[model samples]
Target: MDQYKYIVVEGNIGSGKTSLAKMISQEHDRELILEEFADNTFLPQFYNQPERYAFPLELSFLAARYHQLKKKLTALPLKTFVSDYLFDKSLLFAKVNLKEEEFGLYRTFFELLERDIPKPDLIIYLDKDIAKLQANIEKRGRPFEKDISNTYLENIQIGYEKILSDSGLNVLKINSGELDFVKNESHFKKVINRILTY
Candidate 1:
């Protein structure tokens, strides 16, 4: 864990990536970087009508992620940093949500922005079943997220699998279907130990 200057905790929606990232950052005394998804006004609209708002939603997210990563990575002192998302998450979600032609155009912008961003040294992926993910989503009780169908979650999971398989980054995938690291201290300790031993 100390060898990794930048670590990314990735997972499907409601998989508790943000929570795990926060815990890691605090425990390790690393700087934390979280995705600002709530700031995007197009999110709720995209959920309500995906086809109508998919392109703009993805585009907005891409630009926002690029700017946020660039600013934070550039300004921060050289030290360990834990982020809840990978920079390529924009591409993963775009590929899932956009049409073929729209994706082609989105990829063009994505590739250009990606070249300037820093990559993570290690990626900690929280792997959870769709059932667990849905249950967690419901527990969170966000109105915009209430309508997230199983099919959509499955697609996102598949997208993540495809991207991660070819990413060439050092990745540690954890089976989190039964783990409640937030409330269970043992589970959290296990996660930390896995990172340290990996």
Candidate 2:
């Protein structure tokens, strides 16, 4: 994290990536770019009927993330940046949730818009157990996330791990189950130290 100017915090739902990204931005006093998933009108339906709604939901996210990244790439200098979502990760969800025919159209649009986006300098992939992820998702109480099954979440978790494994990013793997960085200052400090030394 020392020389990195762009940092992307990535994880499955309720893995605390947004909370951690906010903390990093405040700690370093840098710019924070977060995902506005709740703003998507299709997200709730997508969560409830993934097979039917996956394409539109993923496409909406891709469009929004593309626009956000395009603006950031033009305006933000090579200073520190913490983003809750990575642009390419949109495809991860699309491929996982959408049918082959659906993903075909989704990929076409994604590639068209992603041509000019800046890649992250580092990606922090937060890891967590399925049960812990479900518990956290339940506690957060997003209306759309209410019916999220452990099985669906587990599929997403597996997809995330696979993506991170293949990505040549400066990835810092954190076990969210063990580290309650939100409430534990000392633990959070330790994580910061680790990131600083990375």
Candidate 3:
């Protein structure tokens, strides 16, 4: 925690990044930066009809993230920052879910926007099997997420794997199929130890 200034935990929908990020922040006594997914106006619509709302949803997130990071940079030093999501991964999900033409345009805009942002010092990527991811999503009981399909989750998992593999960033991959760090203190402590030791 002292050596690394910024840490990020990344994963697909219902992959438990937020929970892990919260745990890490508490363990290290660092400030937390959670994504405001519930505030996304297009999120529910995007989930219901991805083709129609994908670009708008992605764009909203990109802008929100950019503004949040900018504010953090201006207000705080980068010595103890932990975020649940990476800015670039927003584009990854968008590209994977959007149509070809929409994706092309989105990528062009993303390239233009990403240059202004600072990258995280490390990324902890949680990879869960599709079934587990779907199960977790259901357990969370988000009204908008109820209609998500297994195929969509599968595509997102593939996208995350490909990005993390070639990211040119330090990544710690965790098998998250059965890791319930939130309610289980011992398992959470074990994971925290690994993160600190690394």
Candidate 4:
């Protein structure tokens, strides 16, 4: 576990990746790198009108993800680091959100920048049922997320599963649909222990 730096805690929108990453970073004094989704001005519009906004939204996210990872990841020559996402998240969401033509263009751009970004040494996937995911999304009370559909989330989940399985990176998939790592100290400790054993 000590040797595994650059750990990524990844999941769908409401799967609690940020919370878990924060907890892990705080507990272990690792650098926490969270996705700056709020910086994407296209997000709210995309959720409202995906067909009209998908291309730009994905492109914006792709740029942001690449830039952030390049900046923060470059700093970690040693010591533990945890992030709420993987750079491949852009690819996953682009497939779900973009048209075929749009994704083709996006993929070309993605491939260009991907080689320069740092890959995670260990990726911990937190899986939750769609129902629970929706519940958590609602609990977060983000206005734009209120419009997010179950079908869309399901598609994202499916794409995520495929990408993670085929990622060719070190990954541990956890069935965390029932656990609340946020409020429960026991659950959080258990998660930490599992990560340590990795």
Clash pairs (backbone) in predicted model 1: none
Total clashes in model 2, counting residue pairs 3 or more apart in sequence or in different chains:
0
Q: What ranges in model 2 sit over 4 Å off?
A: none
Index of the highest-lDDT prediction:
1
Candidate of highest TM-score: 1
lDDT of 3 by residue, 103-136 (tens): 8888888888888778888898888888888889
lDDT, candidate 2, at 197: 81
* Model 4: how far residue 62 lies from native, Å: 0.7
TM-scores, all models, native as reference: 0.98, 0.95, 0.94, 0.97
Clashing pairs in 4: none
Ranking 2 against 4 by TM-score, winner: 4
Which of candidates 3 and 4 is the stronger one according to lDDT? 4
What is the model-wide C-alpha lDDT for candidate 1?
0.94
> Which portions of model 4 show Cα errors greater than 4 Å?
none
Question: What clash count goes with each model?
Answer: 0, 0, 0, 0
Global Cα RMSD, each model: 0.7, 1.3, 1.3, 1.0
Ranking by lDDT: 1, 4, 2, 3
Q: Which ten residues in a row have the lowest lDDT in candidate 1?
A: 71-80
In candidate 2, what are the lDDT values of residues 1-198, reduced to their tens digit? 558888899998888999999999998887899998778999888877777788778888898998888888678676678999988888888988889998898889888887788888888888889888888988988888888888888888888888788877678887777888899999789878878887
